[model samples]
Structure formats: structure tokens, C-alpha cells
Target: MLKPQMSPTRELISLDGLWAFDIERDSRPQAWTGTLDSGLEAAVPASYNDLFVDSAIRDHVGWAWYQRKVCVPRRWTSDRIFLRVDAATHEGRVYVNDSFVGQHIGGYTPFEMDITDLVAPGEEFRLTIGVNNELTNITIPPGSITVAQDGRRQQKYLHDFYNYAGLSRSVWLYSAPQQRVEDITVVTDIEGTTGVVTYDVQASAPSTVRVRALDASGTQVAEAEGAAGTLRIEAANLWKPGAAYLYNLVAEIVDNGEVIDSYTQTFGVRTVEVRGAEFLINGEPFYFTGFGKHEDSPVRGKGHDDAYLVHDFQLLEWVGANSFRTSHYPYAEEVMDFADRHGIVVIDETAAVGLNLAVQGGLAGGATTPTFSPETFNDDTQAAHAQAIRELIARDKNHPSVVMWCIANEPSSNEEGAREYFAPLVELTRTLDPTRPVTYAVVMFATFKNDRIADLFDVMCLNRYYGWYVATGDLATAETYLKGELQGWVDKFGKPIMMAEYGADTLPGLHSVWDMPWTEEYQADYLDMNHRVFDSIPSFVGEQVWNFADFQTSNGIHRVDGNRKGVFTRDRKPKSAAHALRTRWRGLENQKPGTSN
Candidate 1:
């Protein structure tokens, strides 16, 4: 399947801004008629969860409908028109003018529907979408909805993050040529000073897919014509961390020497491998130094905010970080494209969190049952989990910034059905794209001895809160346990290892002795101890901190206001740990803002 590409010829109409919204506790209509009865309006690219003043409406876990009107351009009559939903959370059922269009079940990826015949050109049409945030065992990021003692419905799940829902992305009407280039798959390799770019483009019809590689100045450097071929770039500048240089690959659909449709995507000439105990980028050992981040904010919740996005990038630059993981889900495509321009390494992840089967173990303010809870062993949950992996790869496969594909974040690898659950998923990810390495973040509770699938990945990704979760404010004990645990992984797997997550919850301005917990000094000491242990291990390749910034989580005693594990506060202000990280990471010249080795 090919991903739709953008072009100068393809026209787009923004269906953003205000939209009529309403919530229903009972079942919503399968097909709505005439004018919608939605009573309230909301900003399209924002979360409805945080939009209302009433907490009942804010936390409602049932069906919510979004209705908006869009006019198809009169000029697009001759073109192939389609509707692109950037994202709709959890499960979504869409309709246009009282007619069912399509339904999509994932929250973090883009899905499109052809509405060429549904709407006449130049006429306005009603667009309605019903979104359900209720997570069952069959959903990827699974959870349950229960009525609380206060007569309010709330979600109970595995992940530590909040369940913010609604039309969390953007909606658009776009026009493309009938025989446009559908998808482009690019694979790059640097040999000596030369670069080899192999690409396969899928088109709508039998047309010559003219592929061109353009330099940074938009000048053509290399080109080829056919469905699949290679173009050699002479004296090619390598794309590296910090020095991320990009070349544009443009595909044009030409018939009888007349240009019909075209699409362009960015690619970096680089390669990554997890070879012999070292993680290599461009064939040199590379160490990842950054944080594992979530797309979260104050009022916006997990909604996309461009201002916050740009600010986060600038902060990463200031603090000397060269990479980050999209922790529990694939973020907006805009964020991935930005990484391409900036040379930041990204470990793109799927929203496969909370698949644990254990019925016990709840943190300070959370309930006990796992995400994809009791029924996690069933076939439906596994299918949904696999589908999420497929969607994530298909959407993000073309990005050069995506050096790896993370199958899941902290799944149950130690439970009774662990192997049967993740084996097929791991196989699916590898079969989809073998160019990138694949791994899942291993939770500490799923120790090396108990994890049946520990050696299944190309690299071992460990998320440990040794001092915070175990030893509790004792750095010496934390250091010893961390070393022993890491050594056990090495002795068993012998693969390149990374600390996918490691942090302590610390409140800003909260000061105490370094031995105390939840204080600035304690967080810094805990991280320092972990770093020391990592340096001593030869197979240790990367250390992406637990979080980039403090973020809001569902309320609990474990958190003060929210999770305080960020190096920077929720407002992007640097904490004591952020400064400490900058000082240590700066000394390693290869890890400077623009390069990694």
C-alpha cells in the first residue's frame, strides 16, 4: 500500500477552526440526518477533554460527535478529490451528508477517504465524526470505563498518561490527479564518499515515475526514470546527528511526455545498524542522548500545538539532546518532518502501551488492572496490537529521521502469554521494513530472567526507575542494582543496549539532601549514578531520559500535580537536572547538537 504524497498541483482546503460538538451518554445514531443537533463549538485541532469548564463533560468516556461543513471547490470537478483526517482519537466513525464514508480505529495516524462522488464540486457538505474513547481489551492502548462513586465515568488503564480524546488532529479536503504517484519507498546507503539512493514508487496508472534527487538548494543532483531504480550521488554529504543534511526526492507521473501528477518527500543519506554490541549510524558506533517524550501540554492535553512543538525543539537544542523516542505513540507527521530538517534521531513508537496481563501492581494514584487487561490474551487484542504496528510503519517508513521502529513501550514480556503475544508482533515489524532496527521498551518489573522475549529484539530497550521505584533515594543501592540488571541483560542477550527510560519525579525548587526522594538533588544524583553505570558497560549504546519535560498525568498521590520526572518543567523552564545533563553531555563532543557518533 502506498502513502499519498503532497504536490504543488494538489489543492488542499483546511477544515480546521470551529466545529459543532456534542456528547452523548447513550448510543449515538448510526447515520445522522439533515442538520446536526450539536450544541457547542470547539477549536478543531484541540482536545474536547480539556475544552469545557464542567469536569463531567471534560471526563466523559462515551460517544462525542463533531459536525462541520466544507465546500468543495468548483475547480476540483475534474480532479480526484479526497478527505484526509490527520487523526481522530481511539475509534472513529465518519459520515458525509448523511452517508457513511468510513471508520478508522487508531488515534495517532492519518487516514483518508475518497469523497469525489459524495460531494459535488462547489457545494457545501456536512461532515460528521463520532469518536469513542472507551478502550476495551481489543484496543491497542487498552483501558476500561467504570462509573465512580461520585457518579462520574472514568477510565482505568495501564499507561501513566491521561486519556485525552476527540478530533485531536486536523481534517482536510484535498484534490489529486487521477493517475498520481501513490507512494514512494526510499532506501539510502553511503559507500565511501558516494551515496546510493534506491527508491520504488507506486503510481495510479502505467506511467513513467520520474524520480529526482535534489540538493539543499533545490538543484537536481541525481535522477532516474522507471518504477524502481538507483541514483548514485557523487561526493555526497552524509546525513548525521547534529549535521542532518537532507536531499529532496521528487516523483512525477508523466504520460505521453505531459506531466500529470507529482509528489516530493525528504530523505537523508544515512544508515543504522545494531552490530556486534554497538549501535551504529553510518557504520560508526553511535550513542543516543535525549529524552523519551509525549505529545502533551496544559490545556491542549495531547492535541497538536505548533508553538509548543517548536519550543520543545529549541529546548532540546539548548540542553544538548540529539534524539528522542515518541514514547507510547506516533506523533504528528509535522514533528517527524521537523526532525528530518534538524538532524534529530527519532525512535518512532506505536501506541502499544498497557498490554500487561497481571492483575496487580498499581502506582500511587492509579488502579491495578492492566491495559488490555484480563482479556489481553485473546485474539482480538493481538490483532489490534499488530494493526497499530502496521499503521505506524506505513505512515513513518519514508522518514530518514526515523532510525528505528519501536514495537511497543513497556508491554508485558514476563506474563504467562508473553511470548505468544509479542512473537508475531515482532515478526510483523521486521517483515514490514528490515532497513531499521526494532525493539520494545522493557519494563523493570519484567526482569531479564522472567522476560521470555528478551532476546527477540535487535537491541534491548530498558525502562528502569531503580532508585525511585525500588531503593527509594539510595543512589549506592540504585547503582548496584542497575549494574547487576544491565549485566544480566548483556549476559543473556549480548545485544546493543539502551536505557529507554530512567528518571525520578522531582518538583522544581524542592531542595533536600541528595539522599532524599522527589527533590531536585535526588533526581540529579539518581541520573548521575545511572550514567556512571552505563559508561562502565561496553554494550550500552544510548540513554534517552524518562521525559523531556514534566507533563500532566491523571490525578494520583504518586504525582504532586502531575508527573515531575521531566528535566525541564511543564512550561519548558530548565530544572536542576537539566543543567546537570547539559554539562555532562557537552563534554562528549560527538553528541553536540548537530552530530552523533
Candidate 2:
């Protein structure tokens, strides 16, 4: 929660490079099997499913073991050390030298375990991590590990992305002071030309905390005292959409005139508000025009790749966009940091996707995407869902890039007792940080009349698919129908709304005579229609395409090679729709007062 930076008193070591990995159907013991190199070798912070040539390993729905050897440095004897696993697929179990350390359930967030006594200075230890990518009904992204009559195991999920499982993020060892900073929460606002930053610092022990705000040149602009306080910056260089200027802040914990722990965090001076169906950033409505993207690529799967992160933003910038939603799951911390420095609005969503059981269970009667539902919102599932929300907010609350917190994406909101399920979740998010707005991405099947959870949101985010899913190949009828749906949302609530997901499945080089579906021509025309309808609606505040690019997903009959709804291809090549987006967004980018109230 400390925004993941180098600790002044902490010694950091990268446990990346190569790791011993093996795939197994059953749980393996902690004992070392002879030569780990002779077995299948894979890189750390990557997906094993895409590493091998055999389809069996790619589709294996059971446990995979990752082992490594680590020795603590003797120079840091008095510091408290911990093993930090950034992510471990769906479920993870950690062990240090045949002794069980701890376990974490969710896969997308960072989890750390204290191994101070278990590991000694200059002593080597076997660090075994058992990761299971098996998805059950209770998992946040619901899917099943089903075996056929021939004993062939397969991974089945409702989401439209491949189940790439492994250590998708970095793993490292870090040392901290005996008493150090545990977490920091920051909330900022601007009054006229002055910037106000209010923060709360939590430490392991009681100590005097000193806070300093520095400009881009690293010169101190303001200072404050105490564990919780505010710091003001005069004539603050405001963080805007295109030109994002950031200021650095350092929080130090001192004990008896000794600096025990220090942390440096960066933030932007900005404000977000919703006033009478207008989404305002920095006291005015900021038009959002971007896409809902996934952490996906060619060979790396969902693994965090620096090259893909940099290229994807370039595509977004080329399209003249300003915002995006971490649709279906929370992205890595590095993505948030990039958005902070580059000035992009983010709707940080939780991994509570695939909760709509009706669509997957044939109860919805339409061919909709699958939802992650445990069927009923009972104790264990609810607690896991709630904990994900808490950790997401805790880790991302200090980021100036995050404008809103999307609690879920396409959950079973219209089901019975759905209000009881999400009300507490919304209230919990508000309790954690009351500064940002809270909302979720509603699926296309959700209706305004029977919508059980839309009232709990500050902004109405609807994933409408009028031209593609409902009307199919007809853009004429889809245009009229789409306008009706947009008007229905505004008439029902009159709240600020965003078109979270919209686009058609388009295949590159697939030509059509008259703009048929699946052709690149149809994609551009489909988005053109949606844009035409959105520009006429006054209450519509934003339009986020369904996907920035095509990505991998489970093999199915309907999916040709995965969902082809991207403006760009899987390799980041632009389809025809990419030009349509650029042509429209470029004009909007130069306009002031994004939304006319």
C-alpha cells in the first residue's frame, strides 16, 4: 500500500531471471527432485501456459510448482525481511525450506509474508511456491477445471480472455526497519490556484512523522508534521489530461532524531467531481475517449511486459484519447504510475468479473459473455470479493491517476438479493476512501427497470452493444435502438453515464462488400454509428471502446481466433476503426469544456 518504491532503509534484491518450474496434476511435496534444469525451464514473471509447445501444458487445469533458492545478505542482520510475491496466478501457497510460510487466494494483488526467523543471514533456503490456476465457482473469475471421459483436463472460463497462469509479476526480497512505514493514504484537491494534499501515514510503531512536498526540480515547496496531516502548494502546477505535471512527497518516520524509515511518493494536484450528470475533472467536465484494455500480448500472455505497456499508451495517445478503465481486473502498479505521469484518467476496477450466473446458466436467454458467480453471495465468496475491494483501494488510493473505483465488471446485479451483496461493497469502498466516485460496468443484458445495483453508483457505466450484439449486421436499426437505450438511462436516473464497452468483432484483411460483421469495414462503421448517437446525447459523458486491441481467449466455436473487437490487432496493428477513432477524438481533443452543462 506504500505505492511500491525503493525504501530508504530497505535493502531490495531481485529474485527474477530463471526459476525451476514443473506442471503436475496432483500436489507435489516440498522435497527437491534431483535436477531442476533437466526439467522444463521457464522465465520468472511469465506465463507457463504460453511457454511450452504442447497444448496439454497450455490447457492443464491443475497445480504447477515453482522453486528457487535464496540466501539473505549478512550485512542486513538487524532488519526485518519479507518475501514479496507480486502475483501468483489464481491461488498461491508459499513455503520456506519445507516449512509452510503462508498463502494468498487472489492472484492479481501483491501479498507478502514475513520470514525473519525462518531465513538467516548467509544461509541458503529452498523457496517453494505452489500455484494453482484452477478456477472454481467461488473464484473471482469463475471457471471450472473439468476432465473429459478420456481423462483430458481443460480450463473453462466465461471471461473473454485466455487463462494465462503463473507468476505474472515480479518476485523479490526486501528488508525494512524494525519499525517502519506500513501504509500511506493520500487525497488531494485544489482551491483556486493552491493545491491541498491530505494524507494519513500508518507505521509499525509510534514515531514522529515529517512530510515534505517537492516540485519537479526536487526543491521543497511545502512541509508538514505528524503521522496524519495536510500540505499546501502555492500556484500548484495542475495535473491535466495532456500535460500532467507531478510533485514528489517524502514521508519520514523519525525515532530519537534517527530517521528509521522514509518513503517517496508522487501525486498530482487535481480534483474530480460529478455535478448534475456531469463528470468533472479539475472543476470541469473532462471528456473521456479511450478503450477498455487488457494486459495481453503475443507470447507473454498476461505477464507484465514493459514494452507492451509503453506501446499501448502510444496507441492511446495516437487516437487522441484521455481515459481508460482497467476493465474486469486491476492492472499493475506500474500502469497507474504511467497514467499519473502522462495524465490519463483511470477507472480502477476489481477482479470481481463473471458474477452474472444467468448469462452463463442460460437463464438470460441471450448469448452473453460469462460472469464469475458463486451463484449465491454467501460468506466465503462475499468475504473474498470484499477483501479484493479493500486491497485494491488500499494499494491504489494514493495514486493521482485513479479517478474512480469500479467495484465490479458485469456482475450479477439483477439477481435476487443482489442489492444486499453490492451495497456493503459500495459502502466499504466509500469508507476506505471517500474522495473518488464509485461505480461498476453494467452488462448489456442488465435492464433499467430491474437493475438492482445501478442506484448504488455515482456514475452510470453501461456496456451497451446495440449495433453488434443485438442488431447484428444492421447499423441502421442499431442506430435508432442505441439512441433509445442511451435516452432510457438518462431518463431513468439522469446521472453522468459512460459507454464503457462498445465495438464489433473485426478481423484484419477481411473485406466486406457492404460492411458486414467481422470485416474491418464493419468495425469502423459500427463505431461510427455509436459515436453519432453519443454526440447527440447530453448526459453521455464518455465513450470507452470495448477493447483497445484484440486479445487471446479460450478456444470456442464463435470466437474465430479470440475476440476480434479491437481497433488494433493483437500485434498492435491498426484496423480501419483505429482511424475512425482518431479522426473523431482529435477534434474533441482541441475543444474546451468537454461537456456542456
Q: Native-vs-model 1 lDDT?
A: 0.83
lDDT of 2 at 417: 64
Worst 10 residues of 2 by lDDT: 365-374
Write out the backbone clash pairs for model 1.
241-594, 241-595, 242-594, 242-595, 243-594
RMSD of each: 2.5, 2.6
Report the Cα lDDT for residue 243, model 1.
82
lDDT of 1 by residue, 346-443 (tens): 99999988776452463231324433334444678888889998889888888888989898887767766677778888899989998999999987
lDDT of candidate 1 at residue 375, scale 0 to 100: 49
Provide the lDDT at 184 for model 2.
79
